[model samples]
Target: MSAQHAAPAAQPLRPARAPTGSGAIGFVGPVLAVLTIALGLVLVRDALAVAGVISGDGWVVTVLDAMNGQTRTGWALAGGIVAALLGLWLIVVALRRRRRKALWLRKAAGVGIRPRDVARLARVAADDVDGVLDAKVTAGRRNVNVDVRTTGDPYTRDRVREVVTARLAALAKPPKVSVRARPSSSTSGGMT
Candidate 1:
């Protein structure tokens, strides 16, 4: 007896928004530098106190007060917890600084498409339609709106819609398409 074979199923494609190639977050360096400077200053201050160059009374008093009583206050605990959480968040963000690949990386990189680029491409696609005279296109994260000035042909708008929808559909995540059309004076002259 022979075994039966089955065809493979197709999966939906993810959107064309690819990851940006930039390394760790933009703010990570600045934030880390600030923290490092603050820590260094504290270290220096403590060293000077140990060496008797400066009196430790101020910090010592503060630490004593905190340990003795101030911590019991609701506001103090809340503030300390908030500060600790922020520090932890900063550290985590620094460690995994790589941003998600969904963003367009760079102009030279050419790995991903920007909204403006999408709009320009949509305009070109719309213009390619036979009766479309001019196409103004705007592309957003989830939408592409096209305003078409077309030859007086009654089907011009529908044709533009078809062409643009087909073109943008080539993208991984196709944005919602909206098309509006008006007859242009160019209709009397010919395709512009």
Candidate 2:
């Protein structure tokens, strides 16, 4: 007698696409800083001009003098104070944002988790359950994937997979669990 087997199914391939430009608003902060600096300079110039510190030859000087002596100094001081405040505020905001970005980058790089740390986490996860003869685990991005080899009993294998997944998930992020079992010489339990 001859036996025929069907060919395996083909899987669809997913293509990678380039990232979108939606995050372009990140440039607005620097643009705003430049505008703030320019406005500050204009305010300082007008203030100095009204106080007779600069030559009153321009239209800005004429407008300042037209508002009366008292109003002119008030306007100049107000403008100077607003400009100074804006400039200082912008600098403080930029520095704070820079520090936050640096902190986020350091955390993403796993802070102080070296190769030895990973190996230790994997070893601890492997030694969790009964029939778990051997296990291997690796972490990526924010998730962990573990592979387990079990002795014989189906219940023990399932229990090991569940316990390891739970323990690793608690310590790390959510983990994906995969179990491969070798058939025993005698069938003591059924596979679920």
The candidate maximizing TM-score is: 1
Worst 10 residues of 2 by lDDT: 98-107
TM-score of 1: 0.53
Give each model's whole-structure lDDT.
0.73, 0.55
lDDT of 1 by residue, 1-192 (tens): 334566667885654545554565467778789879987887778777878899764465467676884426788789999999988887777677464443243332335666777888889999898988888998886788998887678787777778887876656667788888777874365432
TM-score of 2: 0.31
Predicted structure 1: lDDT = 0.73
* Candidate 1 Cα deviation (angstroms), residue 32: 3.2
lDDT of 2: 0.55
TM-scores for the candidates: 0.53, 0.31
Model 1 stretches astray by more than 4 angstroms: 1-24, 55-67, 91-112, 127-157, 165-192
Q: What's the true lDDT of residue 113 in model 1?
A: 67
